[model samples]
Target: MSLSNIANDPNKRMILFGGKGGVGKTSISSATAIYLAEQGDKVLIISTDPAHSLSDAFSQDLSGGEVIQIEGVDGDLCGLEISPEKGTEEVKHMLEEEGVSDELNQSLSMLGLDDLTSDLHQNTPPGMDEAVALSQVMQIARQGDYDRIILDTAPTGHTIRLLSLPEFLDSFLGRLLKMRVKLSNTLAFFKSMVGMEAEKDRSVEIMEKLKENILQIREDLQNHTETEFVVVSIPTLMSVYESERLLVALTEQNILVRNVVINQIMPRNESCPFCSARYHSQQEVLEYARQVFSDYVQTELPYLAEEVKGVEKLRKLASMIFSDA
Candidate 1:
């Protein structure tokens, strides 16, 4: 589908841009947010990467829970860099406030298989960051105030987890919740025989909230036709391979991928060895993308003089992306 087809309508809340690391997913996602905001929509640009670059893209310090508005954009352009560390902390705080002590909470969090899961995540693996970051996005969506929500996701592995979340957690949570209820009832019966009341099931409350969030997202994704998935990749072997895998995964989940953005294609100007080699490599990858993905592919951003970080540079980058050349 065309940009006009997607952007003209404001109801499309979840616009996702994802692909390999350093493939310009953030830049394109930021540009799309800026472009949409310029069109008079209230746009919230969110970075679902632990190592966020949205602040760098906007040339502003956008930390904390506040939404910093972009100056020049006609409509609302709020930028957020989600902190998953904050998310985990929030969950911990909620548990604590509900009378779960620091000691008990720590032991509870540490005693389960979740402790091993914590170790795996603490290693700073690629996809774990994305999974945690996706929760941050869901939190923003839950607020339900924005005209559009643009998700600038982490690399492919993380993004794969984020997209698969609906299917991945749905059945998993269902079975776990059932088992928890059964076990809780069994424990309650034992406690009654001993003349003691059973412990309240706060676990059920938490699961219900989580399930609510997941189901709401699933519904938003299913019905929100304006929600589009844009993939960004450079014309290189590794990026091509990663993008293809992501596409296949999204297809399997029945997610609609609207565009494949090829970032940093080598320009045909210079005859330098590096540029020439990159040009040839990009040409091969572009051919592969067209054959495999066809019309879903849209826009090729050329290599720039320096990495795009500041707002001025990002504006130039945006110009090129939205340009007809």
Candidate 2:
């Protein structure tokens, strides 16, 4: 399960890095994206985290939610930071496209339900941000612009919601479509009785388009050969515990997870008593992780003296992770 496998596999189009924050996820994911791009694969490394660090990691600004070509790498690499506002607006715009909104409004107006339009815009779903973020990236994958996409997600909670969102959204929208269909049917019965005509089912049209957006990502998510979730955690108790819970949740959602990176392992130093003590302490946690995540490929990253901030430093980190490749 070397990352070389992901870089080489035609089906492995997406590699998602997720875990508790501050576990070196941003650095690791960024480095992996660079490594893949360096391998002659066009790569897009995007973050859906509200608090974005891609700009810092890449030493460039990726703010504004627009894709920017990364300059320092010879390999093709692009970056984007999906803000909550952008994600919400993307979903809103998707729903409103193809005259769906006009038809919806016309139907509502005909049914004497113009008030529901305001409610539709006001009502917010739980994972609207995550759902739209995923939808946007998946759309790119389906379009085949990049050979691989490295998804640097928010913390574990948000990512878990994202994995589960497709199913939840499907169910949610299915219910709304059902209600709309029933209401329209009822109206049709009355209209027939009055020798009038029933309006077309615009809700069905809208829901179908929304459902199409999730289909590709949802299928790729469950297909382990197509996508993989890499869990990153430090050699600490709390991170280990959270990683375990995250693993369970990912299992529940049927998302594929094959790699676990134990970042920031302290190196032994006999001269420094503190380093020696912490090094031994970290080994215990590492051993626990090796046993707990034995089912997955494990990579240990030694604590570095310098921050993994620049392209060269990121290259160093990537070598440590994918030296064999």
Best candidate (score: TM-score)? 2
Residue-level error in angstroms, candidate 1, position 245: 1.2
Model 2 over residues 169-212: C-alpha lDDT tens digits?
67776766765776677777878999988655455676677667
Q: What C-alpha lDDT values do all the predictions have?
A: 0.69, 0.82
Model 1 TM = 0.83
After TM-score superposition, what is the CA distance of residue 68 in candidate 2 from its true location, in Å?
Answer: 1.7
Which one wins on lDDT? Answer: 2
After superposition, the stretches of candidate 2 with alpha carbons farther than 4 Å from their true spots are 8-10, 93-123, 190-201, 270-277
Error of 2 at 62 (Å): 2.1
Judged by whole-model lDDT over C-alpha atoms, candidate 2 comes out at 0.82
